[model samples]
Target: MTVKQLSMPDLVDACVQLDIGHVGLWREPVRAYGLEATAKLVRDAGLTVTTLCRGGFLTAIDPAERAGALADNRRAIDEAATLGTDTLVLVSGGLPPGSKDLRGARERIADALAELGPYAERHGVRLAIEPLHPMYAADRCVVSTLTQALDLAERFPAHQVGVTVDTYHLWWDDQAPPQIARAGAAGRIHIFQLADWTTPLPEGVLDGRGQIGDGSIDMREWKGYVEAAGYTGPIEVELFNEGLWARDGREVLAETARRFVRHVIA
Candidate 1:
């Protein structure tokens, strides 16, 4: 069991207390402390770094910017390797400014993935495509469901391409469980992410992460499906809440660890 708070302040405390992990950090956090230092902190704390929070945003209207995105992502892969993380959560960016055609946006993502997949494979890391909730379809990601992510995954080698099923985004989806099961059967379940969904989104359709069992997600049933699909990986919790982030980082970590054990696996 892992609590994915993703706030810089709470990370190490979760590592030491929960003994699983508390955060899935972004590059900014890494940069803040310097990559090597942060990696050392994560290691010294004995936290299991599941997957780096992000690594892909290879969609841009300008050709040069798109190239830059891919180039930047390669560095992200390298950073993940340095951290000894085996997966880099790939968030396929949304459509370019003023674009409404989803197919075109999807093509951009697939193309970027095709270019990066082999590289990730060589580095002994897998790229996990995170399909955002439909609410973010227009601005954050075009692939807004597990089905769509799986479809894109099929285009690459299984060892190189996989999908991330975030509970916050997919819990409401009737088709998510089956697709997740299928992904498990196909050996494409790279990461199992959990985030309870709360009402009154903090970011207005952007923030809905809650502590495990604090919201409406039925983890017992969901975990059952994941196991039935043959996935026996770590369950990572990823949450983004201003209230949590504003608290003492260490306490946040300790509490998350307690709650994860109390509710997630109790």
Candidate 2:
């Protein structure tokens, strides 16, 4: 009953060999292996895609770019549906470059999502708003807390909107546990994402998420709260560390699975 860390077939095959329980994937992984090929390999290899790690970032300075972002999100939603994945984790894009008004950027994000609600419903995918770290407020996400995500999700109904809880961004917030509980009570706990925080953050820290157990987060305690609130879904590992990415992808995934099972999962 522990969380699993899986990637595409090569990484997933490595994870399965180590007995990792589930995997989180992205569009590029599909593109690299081709969706059908990746899916079939996952089936034959006995791996499950716990969640899809992204499908947001509709931020732009002009109407045309905004339109393009929205269109891209729609395609991402459809891709999630096509893959038979249940949760579409959203990394809501932050303020447009050179934009000083955070609120204005948030409004644009909301409006774009409002427009996409109906389309997402038809695709049978729920848009999980994942608030990024406060550090990312300027360059990555304005939605930086679970409370904010829940509030925004309230604007749209359950059929269209939900909340994503990612430890990398939320683990330090005092309000995080209660927010996790609230998301569960409201049936909006659409996805549970995992990562640890490390020192010496990178220059472009959007990819700063740490591998499990390599940093300071206590996921066991974090998981206790979510489980207490009756959350019943796979715990997805989403490390974005440059070092891990620099290594062999298979070795990285395998070690991620090992740490996830030994430290984060029981």
Candidate with maximal lDDT: 1
lDDT of 1 by residue, 110-155 (tens): 8899899999988888999999988888778888999999999999
Q: Which ranges of candidate 2 are over 4 A from the true structure?
A: 1-7
Q: Write the per-residue lDDT of candidate 2 for residues 3-56, one digit (tens) a residue.
A: 123345457667677787576777776777787787777777777777776788
In candidate 2, list every pair of residues with a backbone clash. Answer: none
What lDDT does candidate 2 reach at residue 221?
A: 90
Which one is best on TM-score?
A: 1
